[model samples]
Target: MLVMLTGAFGNLGMATAEALVRAGHDVRALDLDTKISRARAAELQRTAARAGINLDVRFGDIRDATYVRHAVLACDAVIHHAAILPPTTEHSPELARAINVGGTECVLRALEELRTPGRLIFPSSVSVHGPRLHERPPVTAATPTRGTDEYTRGKIACEEMIRASRVPWVITRVGVSPDPGASSVTLDTLRMLFRISPKNRIEYVHRDDVARAMAAAVTCDQALGKTLMLGGGKGCRITHYDLIQTLFDALGLGRVPFDAFGDESYYTDWMDTDEAQRLLNFQSGRFEDYQAELAARMRPIRLGLRPGRRALRWGFLSLVRPR
Candidate 1:
């Protein structure tokens, strides 16, 4: 299959592209012509060369209807993973809507023009469930969507559009799938972490697992017209406090301070991914694996910062909580 993947240079997109190529599918990877995108594209090319994978990378924005149409027409399947995430979405809601909702509309229109439209594998988010008020039943594909923020709302809108479209589609409401290699315990990240409630339940899925689910969606007949919740399975479910503590421990930063955490609920929650796992068979990664990967990446920095742990904590607290 010739697959056209939007946001092809993104963490999930790149992983999915690699998975597809390894599965004997030709990939037409598309993303913006930004510096980050270009760097990722180059890295992908080098990686593909070593792996003997076929990848045709294109640089363009998803909002370009003509370019999107051309790309869609040339491919047998579409994996839509392009979207502005939080902080960015919160900062620029209009741009988020333009790229997320408008871009999806462009793809759907392009598909509508085709005599034999290809399947669209849309990656939605668990944020569509919005802020959980109380502990309830595990969220499933059947759960009603009530997205609170712009990013999650955009995802919900895109999912609705896909559901109403004539194109064959599979919607995967993915949980938090952070790239272990891309994470750093920076001040900004620390500030964001401090805002999250300690008691909030969060499920994490590895990017590789997400890639596998995306690849399976391309040819799995059982996935068509279904909304699957993609999670990291039993081993990946953890409270926010546990997740932060694990990261702190991995970085040799000891225990996270209790005062740093907020009481407000976060937008993430545990998901029921049994149906998705049964259909796509993509849940193989564990949180322990991710923690190990993060630990390995942070080992050098951990060594450098171990002596200044107390000073670093004090500085971070002073900045996060003035006076």
Candidate 2:
């Protein structure tokens, strides 16, 4: 299969592209033209070259219908992973909507208008099931959606559009999947983290795991027109406090007080991923694996900043003001 993947240079995008290539499928990757993206694209090319993977990478924005249509040409499947996530969504709602919702509409229209035979694998977030902290343990595909913010609203809209269209599609409502091997953490991400209560139940998945699932669904007949939940199984399920503690431990910062956490309940919970796991077999990664990767990545930095560890721990308190 020749798969067309949008946002083909982000952490997840690059991972998914590699997974597709490793699976012996040709990849047509599309993403924005930026210095960082260019660098990443070069890296991806090198990786593919070593593995002898067929890769065609193009740089373009998804908001343009013509470009999206042209990008989708001659592809066996489309794995749409492009979106503006939260904190960014909160800061710039219109831009998020334009890219997350409007851009998705462009792709959907292109796929429908062109009468593409292959399926679409869209990566939606579990946050669409709003304020699930007080609800049950595992939310399923049939769970009602209640959008609490711009990002969730956009995801909900895109999912609705895909279902209504005549296109063959798979809507994967993914749990919290962060790249444990990330070089650096963003301030916006930290701010968003600060807004979620530490007590909230979180079913986190690894980026590689999600990418593998997305890659598997590209060719899996069982995934067509199905709404599946992707999570990291038992080992990945934990409280937000546990997650933050692991992260802080990896980064050389001791856990902070519960008072530092947000007052309100957030939309995080363990996802019932039995159907997805049964279909895609993508729940092999565990949180311990993520912690080890993160710790190894930050080892040098942690060593260099060992003297300021106390101050650094206090510095995180700066993310929250008197509230």
Model 2, which residues run further than 4 Å from truth? 181-192, 318-322
Give residue 319's lDDT in candidate 2 (0 to 100). 66
- Candidate 1, pairs of clashing residues: none
Off by over 4 Å in 1: 46-53, 183-189, 321-323
- Clashes (N, CA, C under 3 Å) per candidate: 0, 0
Estimated TM-score per prediction?
Answer: 0.94, 0.94
Tens digit of per-residue lDDT, candidate 1, span 131-185:
7637584788888888888998999999999999899999999998877787544
Deviation from native of the Cα of residue 300 in model 1, angstroms: 1.7
* Window of ten residues with lowest summed lDDT in model 1: 314-323
